[model samples]
Target: MTAKPPTPVRRFGSIVGTVLTYVAIWLGLVLLIAGVGIRWFWGRITVRDMMISLQNVDLPAGYTREWQGFYGIVVAPLVIVLILAACHAGHALRVRTRRLGAWDQRPRRQRRRTRALSLGLALILVVTGASVFSSSVGLADFVRASRSTMDIGDYYAAPEVTGSENQRNIVNIYLESGEQTLSDTNLFEKDPYAPLEEQTSDWQSIEDYQQYQGGGWTMAGLVSSQCGIPLKGTIAPWYGGGNTAPPDSIRTYLQGTTCLGDVFKQQGYKNVFMGGARAEFASKDTFLQDHGYDEVKDLDLWKNSGESEKDFRPDWGLSDQRLLDHAKDEIDRLHAESEKTGQPFNLSMLTLDTHEPATAYDYCPVDTESRLISVYQCSMEQVAGYVDYMKDKGYLDDTAVVIQGDHLKHMTSSDSFHEQLDRNDHRSIVNRVWVPGQENKRRLRPGIDQLSMYPTLLEAAGLDIRDHSAGLGVSAFTDAIPGGSAQALGPRGYRELVATDSKDFYTRAWDGEEVHG
Candidate 1:
């Protein structure tokens, strides 16, 4: 009798099995690649950052490009090969099994080979799944541990206007990757921020006090500086969403929260945030606009506002020089508008030239082993020049200029000259407050963090901050309350202050929980 052809049902089942096997293999590979990539790129994966990505928040253009580049270079081709190999193997196994007819009829060697192949693939998938699951559980445990512990207590001063309407024009500049390490003589042959040091030395420096807070990057640093709280993300969906909801919608993230911009808005100040980099990254646009910024102009905004085509967009955004130039012009316009409205203005500027990973724009005189040093030096000159311009324009006379590094340089000890230095000893941001035309005053503040700047911002603008504590941070310029200062917390306490998600008093502020003194 002739061998009967396989039924359509059998054929379909075989095909389905093959497809399922291929899909399983592909998924395993993809998961492995993703975990490895995140680990490599981010150094450490935080729930907050993961949530931001899951929420589909638009990352900066440069970052997006880099991510795509990484995928193209690493994942895409590997996935295709894996899928094809898995499919081929499944098809061959299926054909072999079919030819064998019954499992008992098949040769022992053939049966064992088939069983081994099936078991091997299953084992790989099982292992991969277990790994992913364990990692997720680890993150959850970390969050739980953080939330259970506490450091920052009920440290908030309700920010009442003490004396006069201390509404000085505010020029706040955030230098990217600018750190105290740049000035550490042991780290470099020559100080990279020498120019910045000279300019800001007369201004108030918070070098004596340094502590880790909620700032390790640009966006977090900005939030920490403005809110007197670290930008810690909640595991539960923020802004009234369920736990599994995405964090994409940042517009209402701070609905109940108050920031420096909000305070300025309440005080009748025109708040403007100008940064050369894309403001869309890290929900900066949403955060700033929603907080109280009247105008949030970024590189895209500048381009749309009729900038010359001759200006080539670099990998990041506009160069520091160009950004400062544009900032000067924007300040002039805001000053003019403020004059007409008789309202004080807050000009928030973020520089992009000194950003990390690589230096795309270098215009520094310093000769250094690391390119980052050169970048910082270049930034220093531009910052000093801008300050000088403000002085020449007589803008400084009425402006409270607060120049600070958004965060410590995002380089490993091996990545720079700080390889030999203790991590804690070398990690600090550049903090300087200059009340244009006032005799430069040096305050002996020690062990401060990013949160200190929030109250200090108002203080520099001439407001006498009652009790000096605003939100979770205290002002570096004022006398510290007993439990308020980082010195009181100590280094370990300071780290714990921002590390745990449980500091409801501090984290709740992000969700607009009313902070009481």
Candidate 2:
């Protein structure tokens, strides 16, 4: 204004500043898109899950939904819409400026500034990309390094063509802290009260189709049993950092795509998830949906409902007995639906009553955590009662029962059994597949996983096995045992797969590798 020195240049300078701002914005957006995408797969997207997955991220007090869009479906459309709007606005502005005769007056200086801004943005992208792939963003490096798909159509792949000819309902009854030995017949061995048998029956000996000695408790060893994969994920303390994976757990670990549910769905069977929790990996919702499951009962929902607790109150809600009853009702409902739709029904039920913190009172005659075995006996009663109900309802014969434990109790945590009981050599994740009266005994050695549950069950359930790729899950019952895999005692081993929250742990795995792209 003061002398109007180079009016054209001044206008150009203003344009240049605006161009620089946009350039920076664009560069920032690109970095954000790339950087965030890398993190999403590496970590859980939940506001809290971020802390579990990323080493460098910290969640302060009361941070929720401050950011979103971890999944591609959510983020993609948003980005496209924003870009289109900006482009439209810019085109209109240019047209108006040209009509106003401002195009001719717009300065070369403005173009120069725009070019400079673009250059700066390019530099920032370079820096961000390098940092992202470097030790600073270890997640990208890990995912790129370990991601592997299944071996489909290969000779090693399980045959899917004739998997469902013979049908058996697999019931895996997991007794947490189950008594290690056969002494406490109450929990597992046998039931004695009315005109019943002797002291107790060695629960498993009488009928054995396929079974296993999975190492440790529910999660650690149980995952191995189901997948025939090594239990290599976050331990109790350290979660997903060093060298473990979940989606991998689903793919490489469980190799469970060929699992029971999928096969049934493929063969015109309805997939239904009836359980007592919003299970983390049950993929309950996703799996059922993918397989076209019609009815799903999530225990998580019931616990939070406004209904009276006492009426439906068991420790986890709707005791195993109640679940069986519910199952009967659901089966009837399903049959009605099936009659209409003419499709066979597949039901997957997860029992939570056997889980700890049961409504059992401490002073109650059965109130005893004396030894790990005693505690397990109590829980087994819960399971026994459920099984008895199934037997009574006559579903026992009609249904292919899979009576197996999900995991061992805390008594089986590592070798720390002494703390829970004075026993040694008793720690094992006991798993079994009950085929009503069929005798096809195949047990995974100790040190296996529950992730093996799906695929193994698929084979047992008369369904063709699909992709069991990199899954540590190979059916211990049928998978070729990798010698020295567990050296511990079973067909499997437990490796605590972790990502590094500590810079040291991250750098250790990274071996101080530098990135310069």
Candidate 3:
């Protein structure tokens, strides 16, 4: 007897169910791939951070190279879909052949083959679903921790610089993705930072400072250095779903936070921030403006100044050479204004040539195969030249210059560069203070965290902050003295402390529990 065909309603239901199953499977595969890929590419970032940062950040124009790691991910879904379709087609073909009495007496091997294929398909679907669910739970937990953390309100209290007598001008240079390890010849065949080491021998170096336990990105490093507090994703998006845009602006992210910029402003110092990248990107402008900076400038300013895109690279705004040139002009302008108004100035700039995944900028020297190494060499040259220019113009007469890397090298593909360095050695960010008068001063301690730079900058400007600490930080210089808390937390201890405290601290911080409190 021949079987009757299903009704129209039943047929429609079957098609809809099949379509929904395919869609669900595809969605699960994507979630699994994204979660795993993010962890692999950016190991230092938390899932919450990846969510929050991407909300306001766009991949740079030349970031295609960075996505090379994910080529497998792109092909994975198609492969899965094809396998599923092939299995279904094979089963349908076998059934149709049997119904036509052509395969009614199927061999035992064929029956076993069909059974194994069914099991394998079921296993794949089960594993994919489980992986997606697991990663989704992890992401949810991270968000919960972020939102339930203590409030950060009043964590960064304003320092009392009311009775300040000597206030020198400040010049801060933030080198992107720089590290002191570049100076170690063991890390590279040729010493990339030899020139920087030779020229800045008189500068104080803090080899012990830890970075990225609290925050890992550029803005995080900047906020940590200035406010002595790590930049964490405490604010959640207003949308109900994951990775949605936050209802509030980034400026309000740290509404009640105070930093060195605010302190400098209170002391009648003119604050200026300049960088080679866009000021608006990553909400850096908002952070700077919130901290009371004036005259914020970046690539937008450079472009508006009549410099065409002919000189600009799409990877990351302008080259370090152009940034330093513009910075010199800004410094000269600030100097003249300071002289006129009798107000000290704080001119801060972030260099971009060294940002990764490494690109070949104009400043990079010929014959260097590694763009990472070439950028470091270019950075040293630009910095040394800029220092000489400042000295020639007498800008250093009463100015304290702070030079530090925004964060440690972030490119995972730069494993070739790090292959020569000792495997056990802790990768460190660069922090050097060049106080005009105390040029010979150096910190002998093991290392310091980024937080210490806050008080160190204030100290370089001749502020006595010993009585009142710079938030959770101790001056790397002052802490070098015997018996200081920061001095006691040797490199190993500091690393352990950050690792132990970061999760709990960040959780409470997001919940509005002030660190100081």
Ordered list by lDDT, greatest first? 1, 3, 2
Compared with the true structure, all predictions reach lDDT values of 0.66, 0.43, 0.65
Q: What is the TM-score of candidate 3?
A: 0.67
Give the per-residue lDDT of model 2 (tens digit) for 95-118.
868767334334566656755776
Please identify model 1 stretches exceeding 4 Å from their true place: 1-153, 209-211, 236-249, 306-313, 339-341, 360-367, 412-424, 436-439, 442-444, 482-494, 503-517
Model 3 stretches with alpha carbons more than 4 Å out: 1-158, 236-253, 361-363, 412-424, 438-446, 466-468, 480-517
Top-lDDT structure, candidate number: 1
**What number of clashing residue pairs does each candidate have, in the order they appear?**
4, 65, 13
User: With candidate 2 superimposed using the best TM-score fit, by how many Å does residue 171's alpha carbon deviate from the native?
Assistant: 4.3
The digit string of per-residue lDDT tens for model 1 on 15-59 reads 665566565665665556556555444444445445545564343
The true-versus-predicted C-alpha distance at residue 45 of model 1, in Å, is: 12
The sequence of per-residue lDDT tens digits that candidate 3 reaches over residues 11-79 is 686466555555556655766676566544443344544545545444345535334534545567657
TM-score of each: 0.67, 0.47, 0.67
Ranking of predictions according to TM-score: 3, 1, 2
